[model samples]
Every structure is written in C-alpha cells, then in structure tokens.
Target: MSKIKISNAVKKYGSNTVISGLNLDIRDGELFTLLGPSGCGKTTLLRMIAGFNSIEGGDFYFNERRINDIDPSRRNIGMVFQNYAIFPHMTVRQNVEFGLKNRKIPKSQVTAEAQRFLKLMQIDQYADRLPENLSGGQQQRVALARALAIRPDVLLMDEPLSNLDAKLRLEMRQAIRDIQKEVGITTVYVTHDQEEAMSISDTIAVMKDGVIQHLGTPKDIYQRPRNLFVATFIGRTNVLEGEYRDGKLRLDQGYLLQNGMWDKIGDQPLKVSVRPEEIVIADGETGLRGTVLDSIYLGLNTHYIIRLSGGEKIELIQESTMEELIPAGTAVNLMVKKEKINLFTGDGSRNLLRGEAS
Candidate 1:
C-alpha cells in the first residue's frame, strides 16, 4: 500500500533550483535507491519525500493520497541516518521503544514490539547495552531496529553504512537487504556508493546535478545505459571515438564493427563505451591491434593495460589461465563483443541503440 509516485517535483534554494521537474515511481515493497556522487541532490530529494524539505513545485503521493502538506511525523516514515542516531543516554531497548512510546502505544505492547525487532535485527543480546558500549556495526543495528520498531509505511536510509569499516559495510548491506525483503516495506535508500546501490536496490535512479540521468534495474543500467554519461558513471568503461557510415563503425584503432541496427542512422561521429570484460583477445590479426603496456594478475582475473594503435590507452580484464602472463610490450589484437558494447551519439547525449531509453 506504500507505493510512492512523484510528479514534476522541484526543489530550490531561493532562486537557484536544485531539482527541476523530476518524476519518479517507486513500487510497493521494493528497495529503491537514489544513487549519485556528493552534492548531486540525492539527499535533497530524500528529504523532500520525508517532508523535511518544502516542495517548491509539484505533487507527492503515497498510493492514492497526497502527502505534500503532511507533517514529517504524520507521514509514517522510518529514517536511518548516516551517523547512528541512537541516543547515548538510552540503552538499545529504550532506543527501539522511543517511537512506540511517542505514539502512545501501551507500555507492555511497546516492550514486545521492541523485543521483536531486536530479535529481527539480531541485536537482542545487545538490547541492554548503551550506545557507547556497542561497536559501530552493532550500534547501526540498534538504529535500524529502532526505526522498524515503529512499523512505518516507508523506510528512508541516507548513507547508513558510510561510517562502518569496509568489512562491516559489506556485512551490514547484506543484513539490510535481507531484513528489507523480509519486512517488505517500500524503502527509499540514498547512497553515493555505486556497488552498494547495485547490490541492494530493486531499482536505481542515477542522479547528477539533481537530474536523474537513468532509472532502471542494475543489470539494465550497467549493460545498456541510456547515454554515454550513464554508461561511464555506472561502471568502468573505455570511451573510444569512431565514425559510423553504411551500417558499420570504423573504430579509432582501425577495427570495423558492422551491425544492421545502425542502418537507419546517417554517417556521423560516435563515442563507444566498451567495458573491460567486453574486449577479448582475437585469433590472428582480425581485430584492433594493441600493445600490452602492463598486466596486474589478481586471483581469478588479470587486468591488462593496453595502448591501441591509435594511441589510446584502455584496460581489459581477462580470466586467468594456466599459461604464463602476457608481458609488457607484447602486440595483441582485440575484438569487442558487438552485442555488449554501446554506441553513443557524437555529443554523448543519446545512444544509437534501439533498446536504450529515449
């Protein structure tokens, strides 16, 4: 029942607008993420949904009801912030019970509800510990438990794992994903980490300068981005210039890629996005020629830096084999996976592929 629909939303600080005429649809029981770099206004949009920021322009709805005028407290939202906001003065149990008490839940019911979420978050053993006594990860668990103890209609998380260490961040992200699926709450998570968003979100809206450049599932955005910026931002991609004419593209490295899909387009310059894994070593001399500049051998894969004949440096990842590594200065020919690569327009504004978003 908590599906959220935002229509032509806008936010401005005085005359400078941050979010301009944005629209988003968040399905019920889905973990949706607003992902972008710092100062991209992802947080600004989250606050708008929480009713903390004033709507300078459009309609905000929760299912059939309008919530633009609703108070933050009355909107029925649970928020977990960057810093573990649990009170130092209260024990974990008290922190979880705080919201229930504020809503005038009976004392006995509050205790039971708090106990339930503590168990759900796997923090029941630390229920009596004050915030100061628990580790950062445990403290975050308490914060999550407290937020869900109220059983709000929607959950909003803003960089909740930023304070945790590398290992704990991974652990906590998995825990959060599991808990969200169990509770089936319509949640909106905001984060700057691309990997974190890709791993946990049902849908992602990649924002830049307050505008959502792409909105789709992780696979769609990563595999076939709508534009050049999105293809580069969502993951590591090698950008190479090319010219398209007669249903074929002449890569800068002197390789020709032909596809019937390009028949409708006129001859023009192109920017190609090829992921590291999308380029493979070809037999004989039937592909783009390059020289290996260096190779870093990881356990399962070896990452190689290559300088193409056209003088462009690119990285490619190949699965490790029993044979010895290809040393630097070795000449190699590479071929791109035609179906996996993306071709953007000359200005990088739009993609020429048919399946991409318009």
Candidate 2:
C-alpha cells in the first residue's frame, strides 16, 4: 500500500490552465474521492496521478518516490476505467490472470492469484464466461478482479459505476467499499455524483474549475460547506435574503432573528442558506409567514413548497404525521434551525460564521 502526496500540481493545455498549484494528501489504505461536476478537472487530476497526462509543474509522490517522470507502467498502480475495459475475447478467469502474467509471475502463482481474486469478488461462478455473456455488474466485477490481481500499491478508479443501473450502482458501490477495506489498498476515486462520494469515501475533496473548494469528511462537507457554491452543490438549500443590523437579522418577510454578531457596525445585506429539513412549522406568530403552494407526501416526510409574503418561494420538509396533509393556500409560519442553517454575505462568496472556511 502507498500514501500518495501531491504538491503544487499544475496541468495546462497551452494557455488554458486546467489545474493550478493543487495540493492533496491521501492517507494509506483510505478511500479518497475527487468530486465535482463535469468539466471540473476531476478526471484531469486523476489522469495526472495515473501518469497518463504530463504534469506541467509541481511534484507527485508515492511514499517518498517522485513519479512525475515515471512511466505509467512502472508506477505500480492499477486503474479501472468508466467503461468496463475487459478484453472482449477473454474469459473471466483469463481476464483476471492477464495482469498477473504480464508481471512475469510464475504460471502456477498466476493461476492461484486469479482464483483468489475471483472468489474474493464473488465472480468465481462466471470464471468461464466471456465478456459478452456476462451482466454489466458481473463484467464490472471481472474488471475489478483484474485490477486487483496484480496487488498494486495504489488503485485508481474513474467514474467506475457511471454506466450501471441505479440499483446496480448502489450494489456495486457497497461491494467496492467492502473489497477496498478487505485489501487495505490506498484508493483515489473520481466521480461527479454527490451521494456516491458521500457514501463511499473516507475523505471527499469538492472541486470546482480544478480547485478544491472544500476537503473534509462527508458529514462535514454536507453540514458545514465552505461557501455558497458548495452549499448549493452538495444538496438542496433555499437561499433567502435578509439584513443584519445591531445583532438582529430581519428577513424579507418581516421575521426578526437575534444573532450573536455583536461587532458589526452598520446594516449589511445577508444571504442565508436554509436546507429543507432545517425549516419547520413555527409554533407561534413570530416566524416568517407564508402560504403553502404545494405539498407532496414522501412516506417518512412531506415536502412543502411555500410562497413567503415577500413573494419568494422556499421549500420545507416536515416529518409525516397521521393527520391530514396541509392543503395548498393554508397560511403557516416557518422557523429555521439557526445552528443548522448557513449564512453568507450578500454576494454569497464567503460564509459569515467565523470558523466556517471560505
């Protein structure tokens, strides 16, 4: 296994820079994920680590060894592509054994290693089947088995589950997590799916335009996003306008909230990020008044769309109750979980909370 470290990484296409002076450290045996939208440089960064793309500047290391100029084949790394790139004419066993043989392992040892990984991936039953005869999930298993067969020091997967069905994606993600833990290999996973990154990673780096916006555990990124882009990207949130003055925040709908920003001098326009689950039906008249526009029952919770008196719409999630649903046009007062909601300046660039990162 290897602990990968990258510092001042730069990737440029002529005058256009994709990645600039990026630094990342992935712990040994940990599943670290690079997550972002398409064209955000997640895959570019992955290819750089794999040595497929030349590093324009900076350093790449695998446990004290600089690999910027090392040929990809000599990096001692295994890669799984988005498409199952297994050999079409090869049987499952043959595909898994191909890597072992290429490494010049003894034929006897190669066979033993192939069988071990086949059983470990639970694809031993399909060992004799050709690629065309296997299901997508099974084919993915074969690809995984082949990658792991060589006992690589680092494993890199780029959108490994994108082509699978939703159910298969869930199942395969769990399977990958289990196998990675069992093998204890340092892994770098790249994906654009927020939920997948949240469920599968030990640490997540939320990227934008080749820069990492936030780096932390899944819960930390979700609950305390560094800025407005991350707050809106990681999940659903309602952005509401308010004004901060004299330690009190006045919402557009006339609801006043007392805050602890005692050092402020003059009134400042505020942008607040309130997640659906953090807003609830107020118990009294002191909350923002709104009229429900719609409600949808979703078993455990009911989602409500309300139009505030100021004409802005916001969503709220409430626990389902045995009583009848709140019909549209009903007047309601809303309250937010002050500690859970995020507050930003009017431009939505930096968070107002002192400890929250930008």
Candidate with best lDDT: 1
In terms of TM-score, which candidate is strongest? Answer: 1
Q: How far is candidate 1 from the true structure (C-alpha RMSD, Å)?
A: 1.5
Assess the local accuracy of residue 269 in candidate 2 as a C-alpha lDDT between 0 and 100: 90
Worst 10 residues of 1 by lDDT: 349-358
Q: Any runs in candidate 1 off by more than 4 Å, and if so which?
A: 356-358
lDDT of 1 by residue, 226-337 (tens): 8888888887899999998777899965689988777776799999899999999888978989999999999899999999999999999999999999999999999899
lDDT of 1: 0.93
Error of 1 at 7 (Å): 1.2
Taking the tens digit of each residue's C-alpha lDDT, what string does model 2 give over 1-358? 8999999999999999999999999999999999999999999999999999989999999999999999999999999998989999999999999999998999999999999999999999999999999989999999999999999999999999999999999999999999999999999999999999999999999999999988999998888788888889997899999888877778866788775652452479988889999998977787888999999999999999999999999999989999999999999989878778777878887777636233
TM-score of each: 0.96, 0.95
